[model samples]
Target: IDEFWDYDEADRLKAIEISHAYRKSRGRSRR
Candidate 1:
């Protein structure tokens, strides 16, 4: 139970980090 929740949370955080990186790269490309 706890391990499952932790895994889910880590996945969510990883998604957010990926999106942030994607946006940053997009902005750089727009330059």
Candidate 2:
């Protein structure tokens, strides 16, 4: 259970990082 939770947390962080980068790129393209 602990391992599973750790994996999930890592995935969530990675997803958030990707989302942030994507938004930044989109914002630049819009301008």
Model 2, runs deviating above 4 Å: none
Locate the minimum summed-lDDT window of 10 residues in model 2: 22-31
Best by TM-score: 2
TM-score of each: 0.88, 0.90
Each prediction's number of clashing residue pairs: 0, 0
Q: Mark the regions of model 1 whose C-alpha exceeds 4 Å error after superposition.
A: none
Model 2: per-residue lDDT, tens digit, 1-31?
9999999999999999999999999999999
User: How well does candidate 2 score on lDDT at residue 30?
Assistant: 100
Clashing pairs in 1: none
Question: What Cα-based lDDT does every candidate model obtain?
Answer: 0.99, 1.00
